[model samples]
Structure formats: C-alpha cells, structure tokens
Target chain A: MNKRKVYIFLGFSFAYLAGMFSSDIKSYFIKEVYSTEYGNLVFKCDQAMREHFIAKQVVAAKPNAEHASSLMQAEIALIDCQDYDLARKKLLSFGLNEYDLIELSLRAIEEKSEDIRKVVEIHEIRYD
Target chain B: MKFDTIKPFLCALAVWFVFAYTYEAAYAGLRDNTLIDAGKHFIYSTSLTPIDPNIKKASLGSKLFEDVRLSFNGKMSCALCHIDKFGSSDGLRNSIGIGGEGEGSERLDSDGLVVPRNSLPLWGRGESDFQTFFWDGKVEKEGGKVRSQFGDYAPSNDPLTVAIHLPFVEIREMVNDDYEVKSSLKTESVKSAEKIYDRLLERVKENQEYVSAFDELYFLKLDEIEFIHIADAIKVFIQSKFRLQKTRFEKYVKQESVLSPDEVAGGLIFFGKGKCVSCHSGRHFTDFKYHSIPFVQAGFGKNGFGVDYGRFNVTHDPDDLYKFRTPPLTNVEKTAPYGHSGSALTMEEAVIYHFDPLRLISTENMTPLERSEFYKKLLASSEDSELIPYLDDDEVDTLILFLKTLSYEESSE
Candidate 1:
C-alpha cells in the first residue's frame, strides 16, 4: 500500500475504535461509582450482606489486584453500620461517590457490548 | 469531478456532527427536565418550582388560599378551615364549610342536609405518596387523573389536578341551596357549580400575584389556567406546609439523652418484635401502603364509613376490605382522635384499640371526652376485655412514650 494511503487508513481505524469504546470507558467509571453507592443504601438496611454485594461488584468491574484487596477490606467492614467509614474509605480510594455510582448503574443500561453487558448485570443485581 | 466527490463527503460529516450535537443536547435537557418534573411528584406536586427560579408558587398559593372572595359565600376560602397555625384543620370533629354559622359537627344546613364525615386534619396529606383524597380515598386514578363524582376522567394530556382533596367540597352541605341541581352531566346545580368554579378560576386569572407565579412555574399565560393547574398550585402549597420529616422515635434514636428508660424499652419493642417497623418503615414512618387490622370503627359512628377497604375499593379487589392506608405518625399527636373514625381519644386508647380491636372499648374507663351519643357509645365499649388485652400497666405506659416520639422532630426546619 502507498505510505499516505496506509496512514489515512490507520487514522480512520483509530477514530472508529475511539468512538466505539467511548461508552464502555464511561460505563467502567460509572459502575465503580454506583457499586459504591448501592453499597451505602443497602448498608442502611443491612450492613454485612450489603458489603458482600459491594465487594462482589467491585471485583467484577475492576478485577485488578489493588481492587481485589479493597474488595476484601470492604467485606471486613460489613460487620456494623458504623463500619460505613471503612466502606467510604475504600470507595474514596477509587474516586467514587453514592450518587455517581447510581448514575453509572443507570447508564449501564445503554451499553450493548456483551462483555460490558455481563459486568452490568452483576452490578445491577447486587445493586437491587 | 474530484471536487464534487470531496464536497459531498465533507458536507455529510458536517451535517452528522450538527445533528449528533443537537440530539445529545436535547436528550440531556429532557432527562434533567424529567427529574425536575417528577421530583415534584416525589415530594408533593402542590407547589410549583418556577421555571425562572425567581417566582415562588407556594407563597402565591398561600395568598390564594387566604382570599375569602374565592368562595360562593364570598367569605370562606381554604384558610377558613385550614388555618395555618391550627395544624391546617379546624380542631372541630367536622368543619363548618361555605356558610360559617356554627362549629364543625354542629347542626348546619347544607342544601338543607347535614355534612357527613369529620374535617380530617391537613398534615401529611400533602406528601407525594398521598394520592387518596377525602375521608375515603375517592378522587385519584392510577395515572393520577382526577375522576370526579359526576365528571369523566380529565384528559390524559392535561396537567394533574393540583388539589386531590376536592371531594370534601361535594357534600350537599358545602353546596348552596340556589346552586342548580343536575342529575347527569347536566343540571342547574352543576351549572351553578361550574359558574362558581369559573368565578374562582376568574379570580385566579385576575390576581396578578397568581398569574405571575403560574406563568413562571408552568411557562403558560394566566388565561390558559385549567382547574388542574389551580389544584396543582394549591397542592404545592399544602405540601410545602407539612413535609413530615421525623417523629419522637427518630429523635430518641438520634438524641440518646432524651430517651427515658421506658421509651428505650418501647423502642426495642417497636423495632425488634413489636413488628411496627414492618409497616412503619422509612423516614416518613409509614410504608405509605394499606393494611387491615381488626380495630372496631369510630369517627362518624357509621359502619364502613371510616374503614378504607384499601386498594380494593380503588381496584375493586375483595382481599382489600377494611384495609386502610397506614397513617404516618409524624404529627399523630395533633391529628387525633385516631383511626379512620376519630375513634381513639388518646394515644393510649389508640394503642389499646390496636391490641385486639374486635371488642368495643368503653370511653369512660379509657379517657375523658365531652359526653354525647357518640361519646356514650365509646364509653360503654372501652371496658371490653376482648377489645383490649390486659396489659400490665407499665407496658401500656411504655408504648405510649414510644409513640409520642413519632411526632415531628422538634429541631427540624
């Protein structure tokens, strides 16, 4: 292929990829925020079980070693409502809040990708 | 040929960008608007938040409520019964309406007929969850449409009726003698009502304060004010007055120092096994749903009068008979005598009434009220053991202490 033609093709491909992944990237940030929030509302009604759900969503959405450690810490804090401070600390470390998390969970409904779709289901059921 | 082909491609991209930006902006604006519009319904749709954010609708609705000339008698407005300071209801068993000659529940002529049902207190009815109106939950449809007694459901595209409490005015006593009487969608009584209604509607149109407020909130002209619009404005005012945030129970939980030893015990009973929290959950202290208990009827002393029969009457479901909406206990102290009939005179009696409710309790042994035929019947009923379980006197006192805590928080704004 000609050098100019090759560069143009690559540029167009990059832009299409950016456009396609925009919503997913947004969803990842949203899921993290809402999982933290659903944690808070559920914590009000029940702390231990809510923490379990919270940890599950966190691990599923961001399956890195750091998040896995935070997920474990959230589970430990679930023993009491006063332990909300501990849960808040984990959520803050991830840069998310309850309202942001709720909006993210709602935003996930618009995503059509299967991999993203699976993660959204786990987050939503845990949310409910 | 080369220029023509390039020009079409460039133009397509430009159009796509423009269309995409516009679509996104419109979608976002619509979402925010939905939240704002539905937020009113979440609280109470009574007050309108002005689109301009400068004009206040509650203040305007308040002014309209205080205007006496808005009535057929040219003397009574909403404020006559719902005096602001007096808990938004006259402290009468029933309120004098239209012609204000005697006390509520007194022998007053209404088209020569006496009024039925007590003047229910006005607190908490402004809460968005409260769609049921009158002593009976008779006016609201599933979609929040106004289904009047003689009129068809207002059109769906129309605004929701502002005030859900209009059925209170349809009683014969509230209407004038000369008001034209109609049987179908026609009649002289209906015509006269339509005229007075139009007069009230005209007053709203003429008042610069209301015209300005409604315009600011709805973005519509004064001449465009529909009955639903007025109702919405009035509803906003009513709800703004009584937000029902907390009660003594919540206070005790927050301010541990205020709780007495008995209140603490009652608190355990309330949340642990007393099962009150099952129905009385949330900050408003009610699930805002209905339940049936065996409590004997009170109020107007008419059978099935105070009994709600729950969503069944609204849906005609047989399982819902005698089921009434669980009353929020925010201002329960002021909205007595309790239950659908004003049956229980004191909180203790209300508790005792809830204990068994199958047998009648005597009013004499339980608490003191002015003696009347209704009072006499209650006095006789209060003594029945089947109606009230023999609580060790301390248990009774503790429960009452817990209940008093369910009032609006003293420190609340």
Candidate 2:
C-alpha cells in the first residue's frame, strides 16, 4: 500500500532471484563456454559402478572397463614379465592410452586406499 | 456510493487477470525446463524405466531356464538355484544343485553336492547398467571394458551374456562334480565349456519347439545357431522378467505418491546421518563397488575353515582382500539370509554386521580353526568397517522400514 514497503519488497525479490540465477549462470558459463571437452563428459559412464561381480566362468585379463583395475593388473604383470611392449599393446587393445596409467591412484598403492563409502561421505560434506 | 462500488469491482477484475497471467507464465517456464530437469533427476535416482521383453526370445529363455539338458548330469536346472518364487534365489544358505533334490531348505537333507557361495538373487541382473555378476564379482565392467574368467577369450562383449555362460558348467551348479562329467565336459578349462555348449546346442536343435523359436528370433538355420544366441535370449528374458519395477520410494520422489512418516524418516537417515547412501547409491541402491563390512562367514566358505578371501581371491591382490560387492537392495526384504555366504539370517542382522560383526558371532560357537579364520577376516575388515557409523536400534528399524518401500510386485505375466 505504501511506496516504501513496495520498494523493499521489490529489492528482496531481486536479491532472491539473483541468488538463484548466480549458481545457474556460473555453471552455464563454466560448462558451456570454458570447460569444453572436460565438462562434456559429466555423466557418460557407468565407470566403477559395475566393477564388482565375481565370475567363475573363465579367466580372461583383457584390458576392458575399470581402467584403474585393468591398468593395475597390467602394471603388476609388467613388473614380473618386464614386457613394456606387450603391456603397451594391451593398453591400446583395451582402449586406454599409456599415459592414463600414470594417474596417481593407479600408481600409488595406498593413495586410492580410502574406502569408497568414506569418499562419498567426504564429498557430500565438502560440497553439500 | 455507486462510484465506490464500481471502483472496487474494477480493481478485483484487474487483480484476477494479473494473477492468471503470472500463474500461466510460471507454469510455462516450469514445463519448458524445470519440470524436465526434475524428471531426469527422478529417472536417474530410481532408474525404474520399464524395459519391454521380447515375447519369443523370453519364452525360449524361460524354457531353457527350466531345462535340465543345460546340465551335464541331466538332473539339475537353473531353476534349482534360482527359483522365481524365492525372489530368483533358492532360499538356502548354500545351494544344493548337482546331487540335491527338493526345494528351499528341504534340499539340505539330501546328500547333494553343495555349492560354496550363496545363490545371488537375479533382481536387476540384466539391466543395461548392471555389468557385474557373481558373489566374488568375477565378471565385472571397469572403464567400459568387460572382464571375466574368459580372459582374452570372452564369448560376448556384454557382461550379462558372458555371465550367463557360467552356471551350466559350474561344478555342483548344473554340472555334477564327478570323474565322468569332468572328463566328458572338460568342465575345468574354457574349452570344456565350449564342448558342453555344443552338446546343449545339439539338444536344443533336436527339439522342434526350441529350433522353431530360434529360427523365428534369428532367422537362422540349425548350423548357423550358436551358444551365444542362447545366452542373449536368456539375457533378454532376464531383462524382461526381472526388470526394474517402480517402488513406492520412486513414486514419492516423483511427487506422484505418498509415503508414511516412518519411511520418510528412514529415508532421511539413509541419505543423511546413516551414510547408507555412500555405498547404496542410485536407483539400484548399490554403487556396484566392493567393500569389506565384516559380515560373519557361513557355510563351507570360499576358502574353507569359514574363510573366504572374496575379491582378493578373484584378483589375488592384497588390497582387495575380504571385499565383496555392495549388493543392490531391490526386494532385499524377500531375498533373505544375507551376505555372500548367507551368514546373516535377517536384514536387521545384516545391517548390524556392517558396524559390529563381532556382536553377532559368539566365540563359543566357532571352532578353533574358524576362530583363527574369523580373526583374520576381522583384522582385514576392521578398518573398512570403521569408516561407517553405528546404527542404533531405532535408526536400524527406520532403515528397515525404508527398505520395505523398495519392495514392489512385478506386473509381468
């Protein structure tokens, strides 16, 4: 009813809308304009989600899926066989570049030792 | 007085139009993006999208699923272990497939060959994203690459198709553990698997019913047919029959249904204070990753003396010692006798084991050998178990109520 109150209401509405859109604008700008190839792959994977089934069917150590595990197995095998060339071949065959094996989680035994459940909890705590 | 009354009517009309315009605009905006965005999230969270089952393929698979010819012994069927009435699992701590008779616990009376591991339920096994199979996770997908016992000689690219190749030839599963069966089928080596596959193929081809079904599905001659064809059909059947159903929780999430206050409270604790969402994430309530929660070992155990190395036996890596997959929680209430060995008798017992495995295990019950083995398991899993917080009586009850919300009746005929 009064001009002052109406002005105050308008200002609060503007602030509320701004606060909401600020997150959207930042995400849009980073993902669409800047992050490019990296941000392009947000959800195009099952990744390690299906990496936990046991098979007594047959034993094949093909470099498939779960790059970390495959590469780790290959690395351990490489240490024994000392066959870098074969390891390199297996890497390419499994659709992994040799450089991908260099990831610290794959290299450092204990670095990736944090339990998966704990990691998820830590993520929520840090971000949520 | 007439002017005042007319003015009030005009003001009311203006207010009505303004409210109508604003409501329409807001709804339009929601429809264009917000609604779709929310819907996408709901689908992702529940993954309850029903997949259509191919009638002919599934029928063929259903027949083969109950076929004794799939086994070398000509006695056991896949149904012996994976009975549909038992939530696609035999309600036994250990399955008695090869020399076993009767159903459920009745099989325990037979001098049947006992399988080492508990029969895993076939709930969402053939879902497009369900790439893991077995208690040990021997067949699994990593970075889009599927790995199994087949090594470099994997039969199919899809893990489910490859995974289906196991049960028929596995000792005490479908294949009887005998010198004759072993020598005839070469059941140990992968080639023996192929040998048995050819025999099963011939049996199917000889049948007019199966031959016609295969011909209808693939437009193939008997000569052109392969075991992978059989595997794929069975996979399609599993995808159709055990397909994901929309749970009450999914409906509640979509704002299409209501939940009791207890379920809501349970859900809050599940994702919030309980930390269940850490491993039991997504629509399946599993991340499909492995963990060592220190459940008591039961049955003969994978390694004997009530010991199973679990994932460590699969890879032989010290890091993977005592780990098992975080099982999906669909119809978890029905698929009882939990753990890889069916050690926990109830869901409450299973949940309690995660935080306090020793509480359930009495030192008096275990043998001297079992005691040492359990200590080793406890030592290995103690650190991993500590990562999760303890759930008290009320919290565990609410969690079980929330779990009940995940149970649903399949509409499949």
Candidate 3:
C-alpha cells in the first residue's frame, strides 16, 4: 500500500479499538462503583434489621414502660437504616398471622416499595 | 433536463409535500375549536361557587395550623404535612407523621413514624360544597347530619370541623403511640379524642397570642374557649387558603385564555375516551363519591397485612369493599407519588395504573400470597377498568399536559 493509504488504515484501526475499549472500560468502572455502594447499603440494612428484631423481642418479653419506650425509639432508628425488604418484613410481622390484615399490608407494602425495589434491582450485580 | 436527473428532484418534492401535509393536519388538530366548546360544556355543567373567606378567622386559623404545640409530641402541626413546596402535601408516598423531622426525603430518611398513606394535598378541601373527608370518607355529611367516628355525639355539625379532630388523636399522625400517650388515651375512641382535644385546648389557652386571637375572632374568654372553636377557625383557614382558584383549564373553558393543542387533546381524552370524568367530574374535579380504581396497594395498608379495605372499613358493607373516595384534582400536579398508598411515582404511571396496572408491576417479584391479593383487586377493578380506553404513550403525555392545566395560577396559601 502507498504510505498515505497505510497511514489512513492505521488511523481507522486505532479509532475502532478506542471506541470498543472505551465502552468496556466505562462499563467496568460503573459496575465497580454500583456494586460497592449497593454492598455497603445492604450491609447497613442487614445490621438494622437484626437490631430491630432484637428490640422488638425485648419489648414483647418485658412489656414495661422503659422497654416500650426503648422499642419505639429503636423502631424509628432501625427504619431509617433498614432497606425496603426489611421494612416490609417488619411491618408484616405487626399483623402476626391475621390472614386478612396480612394480605392487605403485603399489597400495600409492595406498592409503596416498588420505586425503591427498582433502584436496588438496577444496582444489584450477580457474579454467578 | 434528462428524466434521470429530474427523478431525484421529483422524489424530494413528494417527500416535502407529505411532511407539510402531516404538519398541517397536526396543527389543525391542535387548534380544533370544537374541543374548546366541549371543554366548556363539561365545566359549565358543574355548579362552581366562588369562595368568600372570613379573613380574621382564617388568619387566626392560619396561626393555629402552624402551631406545633397542638400535637401531643409538640413536634407536628397541620402545616407540617400540608407544605407549600409539594402543593400542600408532604411529597412522600406514605406520610412521615409525629416523630418525623424535617421535610420530604429528609423526613423519609429520618426517625419518623410512617403514616401508611399518601399525604393528600389540601387544595379545595373545606369549601362549602366539599363535605366528604379522608381517603375513606370516614367523616362525611349526609342529609344535614354529620357522621364520623364520633357517632351520635359528633363534636360539630360542620363536617370540616368534625374532620379536623382526627389528627390530634391519631396514633402516629400527631400523637406518639408511646406508653404515656397510650395509657392516657386508652384506645382510639371518641372519649379518647375528647380527652386529647381538652388537653390541646388547655395548651392553646396557655399561649397568650392564640388566646387573644381566639378572643378577637370568636369573642370567647380564655376559659370559654373550646376545641370546636379551634377546629372552626382551622376550617376557616383551610377554606380560605386552599379553596379552588381559577386554573388555566378553567380560564380556557371561560374563553379568558387558550390551551395548546396537546392540552386540548388531553382534555378530550380525560372527558371522553379516558372516562376519567366518570368519577373525576364536578367543580373540584371529584364527584365526592367512592369508587374502586384498583390502584396498587402500597406501604402498610389501612387494615394492616399490606391491605386496605378502604370504604368497607367505614361502612362494614360487602359492596363497599376496596372503594375509596375520589380525590379532588386541583393542584394535583404538585402531589407526586399518587394513589391511596402512593404507588405511582409520576403522573404518567398514575394514569397508566387506571387502565394498565399490570404494565407497571412485575408479577415475577410477587409472592404467592401477594399475587392472590392482587388477583382479588384485579377482579374488583375489572368493571371500572373497562371504562378507560387504551391510550398510547403520546396520548398519555398529552393527558398529563392537560392535567397540568388544572394547577392553580399561583400558590394560594
């Protein structure tokens, strides 16, 4: 090939490679950032849920003024830190096993958390 | 020129002609005067009255509405939920009540008690003709008799006054469901409400500014002051502040202004094909009747267990199952996360749920129990769902644009 033609061919090759690799690099960076953020959020939510469960149990066992007050405080604190799924689960437990109330609360909680769930799903990464 | 040379030019001319024709047709559709006439007819059919507020009473009520001392927790007020930024709504799917601090997402992220229902906007709430109150119409007037949780001994004959008594006694809304509050209130009964009201009256009496305002407005002595008077003043303020104002749509109907073509198309859909007017008719854009629209349930529902029986809870009638009062649409654009549970995040999603609920929800994500519950709701909604015709994305967009026309020219409060 002539010198000018060879130069043009090389330029096109470089451009193609740059475009392909840049997209892959961007995707990798986004995946890393999203996964890290999501992981931290999940860990915090799990910890909150555990605390909430323990607090609820303590209130149920004691049923005293101090315990009730503590439970109330813990509920607010835990709710702030808990994820949508954990919140839904805790709210469902409030119904005990009343099928009618359970059915209604489940529907309501699902609808309420739909937006948050969608965001979480987007950020969720499956290594498998 | 040769035939070959002229062929390309002819093709270009034909393309241009088609484009121009389509543009003209679209423009003609936008400017169709018949839509204007139809819109006028729909609006004129409803008897709309202009409001005349008692400025002095409303001013006093305004002060009372903003007073945090009214709540048992001393942290909440009427103005907390009914904020100006979210068009008098707290802007969350479920309202953060009593213990909730700050506003909007900040409150959502805070240690607030989630109220398990959307914070309804306050526009046109306590107007003369607006009698029904709450998502369930728990407080209402029929044939001059005001019926509420109070039963026979309703605190006031005025439905708004009766309605105003709820938040103070409500467990999560204004009163913290703590040991002290629970023991003092006993249960959520009329007697309990009266006790809370008495306490609130005493608190208001302590405030010299409020005491003077009440005296000036109602000519009542500090000892003579009652919760009814407080409710009455707040009612007056709500009536004055959130009463319906002339919207762009109203102006268009009156020939004072014009709507763009998209808005006009949306109006037609709302009134005609969409069948939104069936329930959402009248001056306040609500018939003030209960209807089942089968919106996706959100939060912990009214009855608990992720379900809300809506009107059934109030009436205890099988036929009234899953029915809720048709919410008024004045300043609706500002109230995000629409529906009883605040399921729909955007206006488009809200509209879509009316006709195509399944489109917005993922059945795959639902548990068997959730699926069964949804199936029951779907069955209940079938009749009303059939009323709304299918609208394309563009049509839904235009419909939202038309809804925007319903917004007030400026914030009234």
Specify the highest-lDDT model's number.
Answer: 3
Stronger candidate by lDDT (1 vs 2): 2
Instruction: Show model 3 residue runs off by greater than 4 Å.
Output: A1-128, B1-32, B411-413
- Report the error of model 3 at residue B195, Å: 0.7
lDDT of 1 by residue, B1-413 (tens): 68887998999999989987896567444333332332222222244222221225667667766776666555566676665433455555444566665333342443223233445566666655555555445455456465544346342222224233253235333444343434332343445455556766786787787787778887879678865666666666666766565454443343332555556545544442233544555445555565554444443333334333434555477554555566656665665556654556666666666554434555464423323333333444343212122333455677567777666665663
Per-model TM-score, in order, reads 0.51, 0.67, 0.71
Q: Candidate 3: lDDT of B164?
A: 90
Error of 1 at B92 (Å): 3.4
Q: What is the two-chain DockQ of model 2?
A: 0.01
True contacts kept of 1: 0.00
Q: B333, model 2: CA deviation in Å?
A: 0.8
Q: What would the DockQ be for model 3?
A: 0.01
Q: Give per-residue CA lDDT, model 2, range B1-413, as digits (tens).
A: 68887998999999989987896566444322322232233235444445687988998898888888877767778877887777788988877878788889989999788887888888888788788888778998778777988887889889999899988777777777778775676545789888878888888888898888888998988899999998888988889788777777767666677666567656654653454665676667787887887777777777876678899988999988888888888888888888888888898998888777778889898788888777777777665442355456876898799888788745532
For each candidate, what is chain B's TM-score?
A: 0.63, 0.86, 0.91
For candidate 1, the iRMS in Å is: 14.4
Per-residue error at B114 for model 1, in Å? 5.3
lDDT of candidate 2 over A4-116, digit per residue (tens): 99999999999999997875565445333322222111111111111211111112433443333223222221211222333434344544443443331132322333676
Which candidate do you rate higher for TM-score, 1 or 3?
A: 3
* Model 2 spans > 4 angstroms off: A1-128, B1-50, B183-187, B410-413
